[model samples]
Target chain A: MMETDWLLGFAGGLMIGGAAALYLLVNGRIMGASGILGGLLDGSDRAHWPERLSFLAGLIGVPLLLAPLWAPETHLTGNPAVIVAGGLLTGIGTRLANGCTSGHGVCGISRLAPRGIAATVFYILAGGVTVVLFRHVWGLI
Target chain B: MQRNLFALLAGGLFGAGLLVSGMVDTSKVQGWLDVFGAWDPTLAFVMGGAILPMAMAWAVARRRGVSLLGTPIPARAEPRLDHALILGSVMFGAGWGLAGLCPGPALAVLGFGGWGGGLFLLAMGLGMVAAPALRRRLDRLPA
Candidate 1:
């Protein structure tokens, strides 16, 4: 169950890349989820809410519409505290860093931007350490 | 209208890609992170697949000041490797390891990830709302 199919993953990643590319060419925006949603929530980019909303509507709404067809498995943690802690960290951290996997990992790395590359490396390394600490040492999760 | 349509299309495609790629699965994400245990390398391919076309897009973007639709290409943020960037990334990473959910997959799985997913989204939204003030406070602290 833990094993992932590389072909599907690659194909799907291609779609994600295509979407980012399309977003860049057409809307002239980086397709970063945290940035897009954060801008709307924090009122930093209120003027462009319409475009953001349209984009999000498709992002969330389409997955829901297709939920029956794909029914993707999401192995979320059962602990309420873990869930809350995870959410808060993700929210605050992404905003503070000014990007997430999409902005820094995909878009930033593609452009060879220093910030994106550095952020990507930092987050992934941090994530690995966290996993070791929590899952291996602490066994909290 | 056209731009909005494109945005919609792009978003839909992005979400679909996440779903198809098995990224919406928390176990898959966690599995990739579990190097000490059984590690899954599918994520590497996903990142690679995404970077290829985006690299091309960036190549094109380098030549033009404006998008094909005539809007200015949004400038990249400052490249400075500041404390905030490092601190935030570390925190985000910790959270990611704990939950196996990031903002994108968290949203993508809302429909299927059930009540837990909903709870995570709500909490994350609150955190995002609180972040500006947090950053301001952090900035005021003696360096």
Candidate 2:
């Protein structure tokens, strides 16, 4: 009854965890997603530039690289305007919170930071609300 | 030991992985999984790319190697499957499925100047800052 999407979730978690681990292994940092983005905002991230550049490169480049063999026309279905709006809001959230789910949920919580744990909870609740507004209330989904 | 700093380095690599893996580009991501159009499976391959480095790192850490940042590598911990984790995951899934942007990929997108990345990053930040106060209220309830 409570079958988990273990495979997908694990892979997702693995990516996050692996990145954290790898970051720790190489740079000796926690890989907080928000912090990385923060540095990008102020242009103060010397230690993570190459890594971030490579990571960002990999994010889009990887998919593009695999396009020849995989889905080459990968794009979104929603209104482009909606997506831009969403991305903008999330950026603002990251700045105000000083972290994202990856920072608090994946990395901070993993290290047993009480604040991270708590923040992670709230993050999910907000997501749930968003879905309800967009999907259930607005019938967008 | 500057545990915080070590975490910083690890984060950078994690970010790199997210980038190279195309976890940030929602359009490409939606394109990859889009059923109506060109259903791309590049996400699969990008995920595959992580194997080597992760394996190498795991082995080295397992053998008691110190990270380049001088922190003592610890054993990998299994993620706890609890209510909190589950709840957080569901939220992540909801946002990802709806916007096709996770925190890692979203940030990566910003770096690469992907379309809509700015908006996604903004909401993500807002959600984070509000988490603490929201959590405080949740704590008042009986578990």
Candidate 3:
């Protein structure tokens, strides 16, 4: 597992950083995931369909290419209500931050954006607090 | 030369890859991290799943001396060890350990359709919204 940890982190980091890098390489826009997902909602891209389509396609399609053929299928950790709420909340969070972990943690940090660095720190801090709240404070998990 | 579309596409692929590899699960991540205690190593696959694409991009970008977006990207050496980096990693670990999710996996886990992911997302977003304030605070602290 230790061997795989570095490998997996590298891969996740690569895929994320690489994607952002590629986008920067090809597009002038920051490959901030929130911005891309937001474009879908803001109806801003009504005039530019190809850009949106390609972006959406790349996000959905790349994982299919990278997932291991025999990797074990994992199940959700909790009930349905937890997953749905989690998604909506995350969506809002990603939007507010102007990017998700990939955008901020991976791409933003790599770029040395002070905001990105700060954002990533808050994210991790929040995450830690959340976990403690749920598991220890609330005794929910 | 910057390829906005390409970047979006690359990010999408990256996100999907995260889901595909099961990197989004908190238990999976913690379990992997706990190798020092019990010796489970499934997380390695998740780490690998992410690196390949980055390497490819680096290789191409270096060889071509141009980003796929058709722009020249600035290169900086790896950042030096600093308080922010150290503090950030510890925070990230704590968050992942407690919430059972990080940003990548936390967001990706949305596909599962449950409250854990949803609440996690909410708090995660809240954290994001609070980032500016946090930054202000962190900045005021001594370096």
Best by TM-score: 1
Superior candidate under lDDT, 2 versus 3: 3
Q: Write candidate 3's Cα lDDT for A21-87 as tens digits.
A: 5665565345655556555564544654566556655654454444454242334456444444444
Local distance difference test values of all predictions, in order: 0.89, 0.52, 0.53
Over A1-141, each residue of candidate 2 has an lDDT whose tens digit, in order, gives: 112222333354456567666675765554556566556554556665655544444444443444445332214434665564455445544433445656666655555556556656665556556655665568663
Listed in order, each prediction's TM-score against the native is 0.96, 0.55, 0.60
Per-residue CA lDDT of model 2 for B66-139, tens digit only, reads 77766666543344333433444445544554676766766555544444555666666655544445445544
lDDT of 1 by residue, A56-93 (tens): 88888878988899867887889999999999999999
Per-residue lDDT tens digits of candidate 1, residues B1-143? 88889999998999999998888887878878888977888889899999999999988987897898998887877778887788889889888888999998888877777999999999889989999998887777665
Q: Write the per-residue lDDT of candidate 3 for residues B1-105, one digit (tens) a residue.
A: 124455456657666656544566556654544433353455544434433454455456557766544556545334443444444445544555544555555
Better-scoring candidate (TM-score), 2 or 3? 3
Q: Which residue pairs in candidate 1 collide?
A: none
Best model per DockQ: 1
Off by over 4 Å in 2: A1-6, A44-48, A70-77, B1-66, B71-98, B107-143
Tell me the lDDT of model 1 at B80.
81
Separate DockQ for every predicted complex: 0.83, 0.16, 0.23
